[model samples]
Target chain A: MAKIPIQVTVNGQTHQAEVEPRTLLVHFLREDLGLTGTKIGCDTSQCGACVVMMNGSTVKSCTCLAVQADGAEVTTIEGVADQGNLHPIQEAFWDNHGLQCGYCTAGMIMTSVELLQRNPNPTAEQVRAGLEGNLCRCTGYQNIVKSVLAAAERMGG
Target chain B: MFAPEFEYHRANTVAEAIDLLSSNPGAKVMAGGHSLIPLLKLRLARPGVVVDIGGVAEMKGITIADGNIRIGALTTHWEIESSSQVAEANSLLAEAAGGIGDTQVRNRGTIGGNLSHADPASDWGTVLTALNATLEIRGPGGATRTASPTDFIVGPLTTTLGETEILTAVNVPVLAANQRAEYAKMAHPASGYAVVGAAVVVNVDGHTCTGASLAVGGAVPAPVRLTSVENALTGKELTFENIEAATAQADNDLGGEILGDFFASAEYRRAMAAVETKHALFHATEVAHH
Candidate 1:
């Protein structure tokens, strides 16, 4: 099989590569594009560490083929912060100590941004439900939940 | 951790997808990459070619007319869950969609992929069985056919779909004003797949049970209709005690080999089959559960 040429726009920048059909999107982001902010905790798709925004929805990048994103607009954790300023969700995570080891922070923040975008005034249970895809092994999820709530309040929604 | 090498083809229409399937003998159709991608990574499924129908413009979205709801094959689970048309027409399907794998999985999983994979625990199988839904299938040369849930699902991870057939859409009669339906399940803690999912549709004129249709999944090799329970409730009044009594006979109606594993033993799943049926019937009838 020949390498398939795909053009994907990541973090508002277009990058073209001739990737194997089997190469996963996360591998392309972390290895090909050198955007390692999106960690690959479980390459089997169990862990949401490779979560990224595809088009307008969050998808597990580890399960997605790089070729499948031929013309998709992708947003990685590297794109969440504006210039040097952190997004409100990132700021809340920083203020609330949302990370114990910080392994799951990128995916958590991305999923939270999507959740808050859809439901700006979500309750604690809703926040928990929305973040069900991303798993944190260190924290018991109390502070992570708190971080999302704080972010929700600070964003005034 | 990645799928083995395979040729890839993108289909723009159902006819093109059928052409790809017929040409590539061992190709698999990928819709949302939720079910197929994991299987590929796990090496549970290996194909020489993969025909991605995700970009097919004709195979996305939901439409309701002629007293029926038609859901395109590529319609994502999230789309079905959040669709007001589905909720108003068939709340059972909508609720089951909302609870299907977590948020991201639901956002990526599609109805066609879910049904074609035919996982025994697939909630769509059980719900569509009770609803008597029709599965539209298209083959090469514009050949077409329809199969009900019972006929479509052959066994675990198997369906009646031919190698050259593409599941185009799912058609289900809208729930009438006199009918109520609900799907109740005991989802696996980690994956959220059903352990004992039951879907029930009951018709009541005032208080008398005019008719009932029920099916159980997760605990069986395929979705099994609870004919005994349906017969038990058909002529009786729709009361808490009546629903309980009817669903208690669920075991007598469960057909095929019972499914079990370490997480849920055969005996446990068998018992929960009755319990979930009762719960679904209770919820459908608005009967209070103690």
Candidate 2:
């Protein structure tokens, strides 16, 4: 297979590399860029464990090819923190105990960030509907929904 | 699971995409890659070349002309779900788009890719079939053709689109002031794909049904218009008894073998299709009354 040159910005940093056209964005983030915050639960695109922000929209990175994201800005879970300070959403998740096993937390939090960005004042049902893509086997999504609501209120929604 | 090794070409225009498709044998077009990428990763599809049309600027966005809402082929599901034009013009289309997969899938999946893939459980196909949407296809040498939703999908995961043809846009007739449409579906709990989906569009003149279009998906190899139900509903009062009586004929027109899986059986799906059709018609008639 021929390698294609791709330039992408992840976590506010630029990285230029040549990758196979078959390389998925999740693999590129975890392997090539050493950003393991994005997890790949189901490569079949059924699970949202590989969700990431691409060009301001949340997408399952496992389904997105690296070459398809060429020159696009991608934000992973690692980008949620600011200079060693936890983002408000992260803080809300921690305070609300939004994680049980912590495997789906990164994707859940990343999805929540986008959700709150889109709808600043989301209801509990709205939060549940918004986070439908990211599944959590633990906590029964009670605290997850609470965390998003708290985050929204903390962000002055 | 990694996709098989294949050459990739990013096309900037529909013509370039067509050229790539014409030049590369067994090449597959990649829009959002939500459907094809999964197939590629699963090794269900192995192509020599993968034409990436994600950057084709000309095949994106939503517009209205000639009393029709023209949605570009590359228009993402989320865009359609959120579009005020779609919501106002034909809400069944928007509702169906909103119910497809989940947020991540909808964010990355495009209508053209969905239709071109022609998955049997697809939500758009049923809604479009009911709405009588038209697909604009472009092939090599700048040739173009239009296909109705029913004619575009021939079988499960099959479409009338040729190898070198690109679905440029989908044109759906805007709903008339006296008309209303609704979509109801029984989605699989895990994948969010429809188990049995129904879409109904009704034109009511002072509570009397003047016209009706009904379609069902996920129960058969391809979405089918319930012509019997449509005919029965026409010229009848939009009442619960009439709607139920008409929707009971839903299974009469279903051709081919009914789809069955671990999630649902053929008998169960057929029964549920009738139920969903009634629900869809009920909601549509309610909207029409208001």
Candidate 3:
């Protein structure tokens, strides 16, 4: 198969590469770009472990083809923080004990970032609904919801 | 979980897309890839070529003209869910769009792909059928045609669309001042696909029902318009008892075997279809009264 050229901006960095047509966004991020924060949990679109923001909207990176994202802006888990400091959402997750095994944290945090951006002062039910796509096997989701609320408050919402 | 290697063609225009499809008989038109990509990764569908229409500028937006809401084929589910215009015109469509899959799925899944795929449990199929939405299809040789949801979807995962045809847009009738619609569903917990989804649209004058459009999905192979329920509700008082009685005919128009799975049995789905129909009707009536 011929390689398709693509230009994608990730975390304020623009990278140009030629990849196979079958290369998924998640694979291109992890393999070519060495950004392993975006985990491939289910490989299927069902698990939101591969969630990333594409053009300001959360999308499952495992299902999005690399060619489809050509010339598009993508923000992965690695882009959430400022330098060595953690984003407020990440700090809240740590302060609120939002993870147990920490497998689904990256996707969870990324999704919450968009959720709060859309709804500054989301209710408990709204947070739950917003994070419906990302699932955590550990923590029972109680602390995750608390983390999102704490982030909302810390952000002065 | 990697997809098989295939040729990729990004069409700059609708004509280029149709031409690619016509030339590559084994090619598939990919918009959002929420449906097709999964199949590709799972090895369920193996096409020789993939024509990516995601960048086609003409097929991406929502507009209202001539009393109809026209949605471009590439419009994502999240766009529809958040569009204030769509909500103002038909809140039921917005509600249905919001309830599809999950937040991530909504961001990438397209309404045209969902309808063109014709998944039996797709929420849009039931809602679009109830709303009497029409689809515009473009094929090879610059041919164009329109089809209703019922006429376009023939069976489960099957559509009347030719292999070389591309769905360009979907046009839905705007809700009248006296009209109200709602979609109610019993969603499968894991997949979020509808186990039994019902959509009801009614035009009421004072307390009398002047017209009704009722449709159900996930109960049969394809989304079905419940004419029996429509007939039962038309010209009747829009009361709780009358609505319940009318919804009882939900299964009367169904003619084929109901779908059954571990999540829901065929018998349970049949019962829930009627229950959901009643629920949708009650909500639509409440909205109408308000």
Candidate 4:
């Protein structure tokens, strides 16, 4: 099979690659670009472990194809932190103990980032509804909601 | 499952996407990939070419004009769930959007893809049918056709969409005054797809039901309007006893029509559908009362 040539902007950098048409965005991020921060928990698209921001929206990277993301802006967990500073969501998660095994942290943070950007002051129910797609097995998500609430309060909205 | 190896093409326009599909005998359009990718991986769909239409400029936004709402094929479920316009005009759509799969799925699943995919367990299908929405499709020769939600889906994982045609948009009418709707579902824990779901729309006239539409999903091969239940509810006052009695008709109406999978048995789903219908009706009545 011939590889499809496409351009995608990951985080803040643009990269051109000739990838197999069947190559998923998760594989492209982890293997080709070596941005291994995005974890792949399930290929069946059930788990939110592969969530990444595509054009400012969070989508399952495992389900999306690299070719499908042509010219699309993507932000992964690696992009969440800036210049040695953690994003408020990331910091809140740490302070609130939102993770135990940490497999779902990346996707959770990415999903939370997108949710808060759209909704500055989300209630606990709203946070749960917004993050329902991202699953965490180890933690009960009580702390995750708390972290989001803390971040919302810190953001002053 | 990984998708079978296939050629890839990115179409920037609806016409180009249609042409690509027409030219390729076994080509499938790729939008959000939330639905298609899994099928491809399972080898359930073995297209020779995968047309990436996610970036098609023509199929990308939510437009409201002339008392109608037009949603492009590539509009993600998240966009609909969060769109102030949809929330303001058609709250049922937003509520349905909020109930689909989860955050990741909502962010990537397209309404066009979901409708075209036509999974009976799909949350949006039930709500759209309850709303009497229309699906727009464009074919090889630039011909367009419209199918009501009831006519659009044929069975589980089946639709009226032709191989050489692409779903362009979904057009929905604005809700009328005193009309309210709701979707209720009992979802399978892991897949997040419904085990049984119901969508109810009601038009109230000063605490009396003037009109009612009910549709059942995740219980049959396709979501179907419950005409028997609607008939029972019409002209009836909004009351818990009335709604329960009317919704119980699902047990008789959908007994054999309900689908069975590893997640649930047909008999179980039929029973659950009745409960979901009651819940949906209750919610719809609440909305109408408000």
Candidate 5:
């Protein structure tokens, strides 16, 4: 099968790619576009390892087809920072030791950014529930919850 | 993991979608792709043509008509979880939607797809069954048939849906006054698949049960309403003792083999079904009384 031409916007930049019809969004981001920040831990949807904000909502890019995202805006972990400055969510994760292996950090931070945006002020339980999709094998999720709360506080949520 | 080669057609309308499906025997509908895509990747489902009905906007929303709630087939779990109408009219549905796989899965997974797929462990099946929800289906013949939740689902990963049939909407009655319901489940840690789940509905009349509906999920090839439990609870006082007695049939009702893995044994899931059934019934009774 010939590759389909898809137009997508990622990290405020528009790009065109010829990809197979079955190409997953994660591969388009990592392999085609050369944005390798999004890691693939488990090809299965169980791990939140490939999380990305698509049109303002966090989704596992691995599960999303690239063609399905045609004309849709995407934000990877690389796009979270503004003007070379770390986003508040990133700073909170770093300061609170939210990650251990750091493999799940990008997805955790990205998912948390969207979570805090929807819920400015969230309880610890809310944070846990919000990030339930993203899994961190290293951290017992205690610090991740703390990091999300800390980010909310920093954002004056 | 690349899916097998297949022609893709994005159908913008139900009529067009039906036409596409009618043209091929192995055409499959894709909405959100949360369920179908994984099957494609696993090679468990190999459709000759992938009909993308996700572009159809008409098959979406939550509407109230004639005191019945009509939810479009494409309405995502996130939409249902966040919709105030769902929360107000049918809080049990909202609660079940909220308990699905997770935020990402909820954002993309549609209730209609979930119900049509008829996954036995899905949250929607147990809750919808307890509510006696109706499925509005459209097929190649352009005829619409409504099936109750119990009738819609035939078995695991199977439904009454034909090759050219597409689920259009789900209709649920606005719960009667003084009727309360709750869903309780023991979630599988890794995949978030429910090990044993139960949805309990109670109608209270001055401390006496006027109506009761109990359904169990994640314990068999399909979710089933527990008539024995319903009989035990009906006309009984809303009390913890009554709830426990009613829930005792959970194990007996779950006579079929349960899907088990390293996470839980079949026996464990059966025991948890009774436990969760009791828990759901207790909460439903509490909500009805107060």
Candidate 6:
């Protein structure tokens, strides 16, 4: 198979490369770009461990083809923080104990980034509904909801 | 999770996409890739060439004209879920889109891909059946045609759409002033696919049901219209008892073998068909003699 050329901007960095057509966006981010922050869980698209921001919307990278993301702007979990400064969502997650195993934290924070962007002042129920795509088996999502709420308040929502 | 190797082509226009498909017998059109990619990774679909129409500008949008609403094929579920146009045109579509999958899936999953994939448990088919929506299809040499859900979706993961045909748009009639519509679903916990989904559109004249259209999916091969129940609701008062009596006939119209999996059995789904129908009608006619 011929590798296709795709120019994707990941976290404000543009990289032009030839990738196999079968390469998914998550693989492109983790393997080709060597930005391993995006986790791939339940590669069948059921789990949102591979969730990332593409053109301002969150999508399951495991389900999206790298070729499909040609010329698009992508933001992985690595891009969430600003110059070693934790984003408000990340700080809230930490302060609120949103994670126990830390496996789903990256995806949860990424999803919260989009959710809060969409709804600045979301209720706890709304936060839970918005994060339904991402699953966390250990924490039971009680603190996750609280983290999102706490983040909303921190963002002056 | 890698799909089998295949050639890839990005088409800028629908004509180019059509040419790509017509030129290769083993080619498949991918819009959004949420449905097809999963199938590909599962080895359920193995096309020789994959034509991506994700960036095609001609196949994306939502519009209303002449008392009808037109949603382009590339319209994502998130677009429908958040669009005030869709909400005003048909709140059922917006609500159904909101309930489909999750935020991530809705953000990227295209309506064209969902209709083209035609999963048995997909919510669009049942909601479209209730809306009497028509699917717009285009083939080689500018050939265009339309089909209802029944004619378009023949069975589970099967459709009458030709190999070279591409779904261009979904055309739905705007709900009338007296018409009430709702879609109710029992979504699977893990996958978010409908375990049993029901959609109802009813016309009422001061609490008297004048006409009705209802469909149920997830329990059958494809969305099945409950004509007997539609008849049962006509000229009847909108009451919980009447709704229960009417929806009890859902199983009668559900012909053929019911699809079953570990999450839900055929018997359970068959029985819930009426229950979901009642839920939908109750929602459609909410605050009406409840």
Query: Pairs clashing in candidate 4?
Result: A133-B103, B1-B41
Docking class of 1: high
Deviation (Å) of B169 in candidate 5:
0.7
List the candidate 4 regions with Cα displacement exceeding 4 Å: B287-290
Q: Per-prediction DockQ, in order?
A: 0.83, 0.89, 0.92, 0.79, 0.68, 0.93
Fraction of native Cα contacts reproduced by each candidate: 0.85, 0.91, 0.96, 0.96, 0.59, 1.00
Query: What TM-score results for chain B in every one of the models?
Result: 0.98, 0.97, 0.97, 0.95, 0.95, 0.98
- Model 2 Cα lDDT, one tens digit per residue, B1-290: 79999999999999999999999978999999999999999899999899999989899999987789999999999999999888988777788888888888889899999999999999999999998888999999999999998899988899999999999999999999998788888999988888999988898899999998889998988899999999999999989899889989888888868999888999999999999999888787773221
What candidate 6 gets wrong by more than 4 Å, as runs, is B287-290
Greater-TM-score candidate between 3 and 5? 3
In model 3, where do residues sit more than 4 Å from their true spots?
Answer: B287-290
Candidate 3 has an lDDT of 0.91
Q: Indicate the docking level reached by candidate 4.
A: medium
- What are the lDDT figures for the candidates, one per model? 0.91, 0.91, 0.91, 0.86, 0.86, 0.92
lDDT tens digits, residue span A18-121, model 3: 99999999999999999999999988887689999999989899999999889999999999999979999999999999989888999999999999999999
Tell me the TM-score of model 1: 0.98
> Per-residue lDDT of A56-110 in model 1, one digit per residue for the tens?
8999999899989999999999999999899999999999889999999999998
What ranges in model 1 sit over 4 Å off?
none
Supply the DockQ value of model 3. 0.92
lDDT of 3 by residue, B5-120 (tens): 88999999999999999899979889999989998998988999999998898999999988899999999999999999999988988999999999999988999999888889
Candidate 6: pairs in clash: none
| Model 5: DockQ vs. true structure | 0.68
Native interface contacts retained, candidate 1: 0.85
Docking class of 5: medium
Docking class of 6: high
Give every prediction's interface RMSD. 1.1, 0.8, 0.7, 1.4, 1.2, 0.7
Prediction RMSDs, each to the true structure: 1.0, 1.6, 1.6, 2.2, 2.1, 1.3
